[model samples]
Target: MSVKNLLHSSKHSSKHSSKHSSKHSEDILVGVGLRHPHFTDILTSAKEIDFVEVHSENFFGQGGAALSVLQQVRETYPVSLHSTSMGLGSFADIPAHYLARLKRLTQTIDPFLMSEHACFTWGHLQGQLMHSGDLLPIAHTHNNLKRMCEQVDRVQTYLGRELIIENVSAYVQFDESYLSEAEFLTALCQQTGAKILLDINNIAVNSLNFEGGDIEKSVVDYINVLPIDSVAQIHLAGCSDVPHGQLVVDDHACPVSDDVWQGYRQALTRFGAVPTLVEWDSDLPAWSTLIGEAQKARDIANAVLGVNARASVMEINHE
Candidate 1:
């Protein structure tokens, strides 16, 4: 099917669209990292948050605290499985064992959706595993886009779910960079039958690190270029400020900044209330506090969607 035709079908299908549910979930779908600290509270309490996001690598192990708590939470709220280790856009093919494990986990958990960065993680030069601990930027040339589209297809097939590609936070740029990140992601989504997990925090961090980068422009660029229907979810997180200068790191350690919140409001306006998650990784507070933060995201979404908080809360609970 063509891109337009596929989007048409997806927009109409209950499985893909789920308009009522999606809108409702967007307001309440706040997520915290599946860390050891919040496991007990998450498993025991009736979570007010709409969903939870887990790092795929944490569950690459078996029968551990992470997996155990994840399984328990998967039984209740919706889940969005974000990955740091898929290495989807890399020079290497999918890791067989890792893919197998992820496949098994998805079969069991059945997340609302899954996503990974639009950067390379693993590469082999001289027969050695030269891995970057961070999500390294990719050159958005035609050849690279071809490779990326193919890799996205492979991931979707292997996982048996649509893979959402997220923009990465980077302080450096490649001299050979041929395409803007938004344009690259747009073409990749058009080529592959994938969705987007828009990370507002990353955009803010990237704009802050490099000169001449603006969060508003990045958000607007994405809104203008990518298919609004292709957005499966949105992510909000806190970032750490770089020392010396005003460079900001994409560290999910602190609270969400007011500037990042403005970026999110822009996204809410563009995406029309896509599911948003609060991604707190380090220095997590009590479960209630996290829920409160998530509630703020919902409020922002609701306001952007032109709905009141009471009605928004009702819609989420009903969905």
Candidate 2:
């Protein structure tokens, strides 16, 4: 996941791909999270989608209808395994049993990408280890960074593939930590050869919870700070603005806010059309509605790419 390797991949994938950058940008994959209700709809619908993502824990069974559904879906499109419980930041290493199950699922589905959160979930309770069942934040310090790097390395070695880590929305920030989240993520990628799953909605939620300024700018600045080569995927989801803006929740139920969309455009400008996913989990939408969100992401990316392509052509002609 070094800059050199990413650059070579970009060049190799795009060579003879298209004269227009927009066409190359079409290579940028857009997908929706596969939920239970939409199983038949996703396979039957004629909607345009590049891939479908599933939470890895959902299909760890030896044999079941869930795995069968996934297999049927995989036959039609690529799959991505998004694990919610592989808390890489936990005090202990990733649980071997969990990793074994995930490895089997990955072997079965052959997902296009594998991802988990950058937060910790396991903690000691009265001298006994317990699962928190939620993503918990870790302080951004040198020691934590070293631990994360080691954990990431072990996971990669066991999985025999690179694992992409995602930033989670948080309710609290550590006071003693000096390193910015971006700096920590940068070093993690540089050291462990892993990539990032940039969640645009989480950025906005954090901005509202912590900064309370113009969230769109906050998102743009956050994306700008990350090394471009480190980002491998983008997640577009919605926040719950029920009670007030400050107390909003990262519930992936509503439509993506205008602010997040603006940030997404900025992200594409910086990251060059990375794989983007539109996720709606809680108040699940009809397949048509959910697919509409995915289409919007695809459209925004193509628009940005079209502008870049034309700008590039003009620059070349000027030269």
Candidate 3:
């Protein structure tokens, strides 16, 4: 059977319950990044959010107002911990103390999922350990892939759970890279069992920066190349056009773009329903706006998956 048909059949047979209970459990989960501006509203409103993702570094401190807020949020919704500084692709080993701290946080939060970037943020410079405070792309070569696998293995071993690594948006390409981004990620998953947090927006952005023809097709090709089962989550966000309209920056400051929405649809068709998050970090909007974007994603996913599920059932009955 085709993937769509299989997904449709699985949805009806699956025993898992949706957050709303009224919605299909197999429908893709749609959520927004929990930012400080929307905390009060999220804590008080009667919104129907499937989940919320937070930067793991935000609540790493032992005791703080942020932790208190997260504790309260954890009480009501499923949480995904996204780490910005784990530097999984860095040549330098992740600090033992830092991993220990994250382990403690995991013990406390018991998050439903955890993720970090495929890019490195820390490296040795002039015999000193320096943090770039940015998601720097790594060369897509065999050696770098091996190093990344080692880093992911260390993190998963410490947490006793699989880690999802997100692909980073890059404007520049390295000459030393021997593999495409998709190939590197696929190899990483095969070697270390790490899953992918496929960021559709990033793919769109990189397509615009690197290749200019048929952005949607590029995204579809990228998703097709990935190991389908290795994808654990999906991220949707907005990008900004450069002054000259020559580059698209992954700023995450606006609503989902049309090209991105198209890419997301293709992803659903290829990967089926995955836990998808709507990320809007900069130029934060009202809480309702963020929720609205998530609702839009939910609608699109449901419409696509619902049709496939129904079609699959009809085929089975006819057979």
Candidate 4:
């Protein structure tokens, strides 16, 4: 069998399929990010996905259609909360109101897991709210890691659940760094007891943009460095081709590339099957199309894990 065919077959094969079957099908849930454009379509389809994930900052409002739809969706499928604006690794203090809102949503939605980027999304040097509009990187120095650990502790404490930290797509390299991104994230999970929400696309983006190294090798290296068990879930997103450059930008504007699908399958091989998400943030597709794309993630997870078409753990356990 071809490598790609082997990956697909091993993922969705039966009990007699492969040697690795320790992780259950329930652990291989599929989900998509909640965006304004896809809200109605997601709400419309009742049998579409295993769960849904939303950006914490987007639902920071008191009352709106977004919250209402979220409330309705939670009744049907599990929801995973992902935040881009928390800035947990930043030097700035945590936003009081944002935390409260996130806390409230967690209570209301009862999400299975909540995650945020390892990079700080907020920055205020001297009292002004200087929004970076991007997931800003933190100094990897020991002192910086200490500061970041405290912030992560605070967020998990407030939320009363383990917060999974995702590695961001970094565009620039740092000079005063102490640990590699892998080491720093592994340490964060070790010290703070928070799990990791590994984004395969971000690793690829960072690898191309900054490292200028082999993408597949980079993925394997990062996975090898991380504690395999802490990989609670995985994220796959589309990226854009950089202007006049070979590296692709981590823009969630395109479809999941074949490179990323290969990475996902590799992740399943290394980490075993976990809840994987398809994140398409911009130029949203139709609801059915988005769900179809999400199914691709599910298919990859199922194929790698050696489950059947039903792919439902509840069904697997019953048998």
Best by lDDT: 2
Candidate 4 — which residues are off by over 4 angstroms?
A: 1-22, 25-27, 244-247, 307-319
Candidate structures ordered by lDDT, highest first: 2, 3, 4, 1
Displacement of the residue 273 alpha carbon in candidate 2, Å = 1.5
Question: What would the per-residue lDDT of candidate 2 be over residues 231-281, giving only the tens digit for each residue?
Answer: 878899996776665566788989888988988877777767688899898
Clashing pairs in 3: none
Question: What is the Å distance of residue 130 in model 3 from its true position?
Answer: 1.3
Q: Write the per-residue lDDT of candidate 3 for residues 1-319, one digit (tens) a residue.
A: 0112211212211321232232343556777899888889989999688789999888889998888899899898878889999899999988888888898898888777788999988889899988888899999999999888888877786677677789889877899988988889988887887778899988888888887847887886787788657687889999766775676778899999998888887776666677889999999988989889989888888876675744532443332
Best by TM-score: 2
User: What's the lDDT for all of these models?
Assistant: 0.73, 0.80, 0.79, 0.76
Query: Candidate 2: where is the Cα deviation over 4 Å?
Result: 1-23, 309-319
Instruction: Work out the TM-score per prediction.
Output: 0.86, 0.89, 0.88, 0.86
Candidate 4 lDDT (Cα, 0 to 1): 0.76
Considering lDDT, which of the candidate structures 2 and 4 is the better prediction for this target? 2
lDDT at position 280, candidate 2:
91
Candidate 2 displacement at residue 301 in angstroms: 0.8
Output the TM-score of candidate 3: 0.88
